[model samples]
Target: MRRLIASTFASLDGILQAPGGPQEDPTGGFALGGWMFPYADDSMDLSAAGFDGKDRELLLGRRTYQIFEAHWPYQAHDDPIAQSLNAAKKHVASRTLSTLHWNNSTLLQGDVVAAVTALKSTPGPDLQMIGSGNLIQTLQAAALIDEYNVWTFPVVLGRGKRLFDEGATPSALRLVQSRVSTSGVVMSTYVPGGDVQPGSFVTTEPSERELDRRKKMANGTW
Candidate 1:
């Protein structure tokens, strides 16, 4: 089965909405749409991190798909990013959209989970989800995503769509690799590390000797 990877950008406080530009997503009156622009630098290699549509097929939510369809295709003909995105096969999940006009774009039919599960079993390149927060949440709840490449910027937007919302499954992650860009962006990669193992550092029930020691300390005797 092919792995389903999520490559996304988020703010310090976990807001992941509209890292590209202001007009990307303004729903809910999100005034800080373009908060990630200031921290961008050349060191944040998009291609090396598997964020640029290099070898994987694209899995996008309706909103993200709509955003890309309007922009990438209209870029300069020789633009590498546009070329890759324009040529790659896109699997989009949406309940309201009946048609998709982007090149090599197809809609997943019926039950999003079932469709995606079937897609994973079929032979194909690894699937990559860009900035589809809603889709990410769904897949995350289902534990369908295999890997995460989260680029956390320095800024914080108190209110906006986040990468992992409260509805996200409670699970621990193993940090496989990490690096910081010159512009203070922390780009990290993580993989599932089983369930969320809850632990505590609080004191346990004390023994008789421990209790005596505590009593002595309370009385300033020893």
Candidate 2:
């Protein structure tokens, strides 16, 4: 089965909206767009994070798809990132958009979750999701995504769209690999571990062993 991997750029506080530029997304009056630009460095590997679309198909939400369709197609032909993104197959998940203009792009029909599940079952390269926050949340809630590539820049947007919101379903993620860029960007990959494991350390009563130990201490060898 093909795996679906979600790759995103987030702030220190889990904000993932508009990391590329100030014009990317400002729906909620988010003035701090392009907050990740200050932390860019050569040590960070974009290909490893699935940004170059080297060996995977692109899965995008409507807003992100529009942004990419407008920008990547206009880049110079020799641009490696642009070339890779333009050449890769794009599967856009949109409820309002009925058609796509970009080359090698297809509109996902009907229920997003079911369509994605069907695609995953077939033989193809892994699905790589880039900046599709809405779609990511949907697939994530459905437990359809296989992996998460979270590149966290050392900055926080006090108010903005977040990677994990308050409504996120409780679950566990296991960090498979991680690295830090010279600019202090924490690049990490995670996989779903399981349901949230609940625990507590507060003790309300002492056990028999603890009681015996307490008695021994009080008696002082009697």
Candidate 3:
């Protein structure tokens, strides 16, 4: 069985929308499009390059799929990223789209979680998902994602779509690798660990003696 990987670029505050360009997604009054452009560095290049060598197919949401279909096909053949994205078999998750214009594209029908779970069971290279916040949320909720590649930029966009939202089930992750870019981007790879173990450290009201000790310590009278 092949693994399912989700790769996303996000701000410090967890906004994942429109990291590519201004027009990429203007929904919900998101003004900070193309926020990740300035932080591109050699580390980012190297991280992207590693994925270039991997045998993989793409899983995208409707919006992201349309964006790639419009841009990648027209890009020069020598552009490595374009070539890889255009040539790879794309599986798009959408309820409205009936026909896909891009070559070798498949529309996932019915329950999104079930369809993706079935896809993960198939033999192939890793199934990669990029820049699909909605789709990623569904997958994360289902616990279907096997790996995550997150490039966390330094800047914080106070509001936007986040990679992990409130609806997502609490889960633990184990960091596989991490690196910091010259531009202050923190790139990290993680794999699902298990269920989240919730714990906290707090004490109830102190006893009389304990309170007296605390007061003495505060007043330097211990």
Candidate 4:
């Protein structure tokens, strides 16, 4: 079975929307589009992290596919990134997109989960998802992703589409590898480990120190 990997560029607050450009995704009046531009460095290799469409097919949502289709194809003449994206097989999930004009692009039929599950069982290289926030949520809920390449930038956008938004399944992840970029971006790779382990530090009986602290707080003495 082929692995399904999801790659994302996120802010400190987990906002994954519009990291590329200002006009990318402005929905909900998100003014901090292109928040990642300042942190970009030549030393950071996106392709080395498997985000540049090498040895893998592309799985994308409607919005992300459209964004790539509009921009990548135009650069295919001289850019390697454009060439790879143009030639890669694209599996896009959308309810409204009837026709896909990009080369080697296919619109997924039937239920999204079922389609992706079937694709995973097929004999092929791993399928990688890039910047599809809504689609990521669905796959995350179903526990379909095999790996995650999450690059967390330092900026914080208080409001925007996030990676693990509401309705995402609560699952524990083990850090497999990590590196800090020169620009302070934390590039971490993780795999699903198991269920989340719940714990607490509270004790049934408070110690004398804890009791004194609580008493001081109650009396406003700090």
For residues 28-66, what per-residue lDDT tens digits would candidate 3 score against the true structure? 999989998999866576435234423689899999899
For candidate 2, lDDT tens digit of each residue in 81-161?
999999999999998998799999999989999999999998999999998888888998999989999998899678899
What clash count does candidate 3 reach? 0
Task: State the lDDT at 62 in candidate 4.
Answer: 96
Superposed by TM-score, candidate 2 places the C-alpha of residue 78 at a distance from the truth, in angstroms, of 0.9
Off by over 4 Å in 4: 203-222
Instruction: Report lDDT (CA) for all predictions.
Output: 0.92, 0.92, 0.87, 0.92
Error of 3 at 197 (Å): 1.4
lDDT for 105 (candidate 4): 96
Q: C-alpha displacement of 78 in model 1, angstroms?
A: 1.2
**Model 3: runs farther than 4 Å from truth?**
46-54, 203-222
Clash list (residue pairs), candidate 3:
none
Q: What is the TM-score of each candidate against the true structure?
A: 0.91, 0.91, 0.88, 0.91
Model 2: residues >4 Å from true position, as ranges? Answer: 206-222
Error of 2 at 146 (Å): 0.6
Q: For model 4, how does the per-residue alpha-carbon lDDT over 1-222 read when each residue is reduced to its tens digit?
A: 999999999999999999999999898998889999999998688996777888789999999999998989887387878877888999999999999999999999999999999999998889999999999999999999999999999987899999997798999999999999999999999999999999988858998998999999999999
lDDT of 1: 0.92
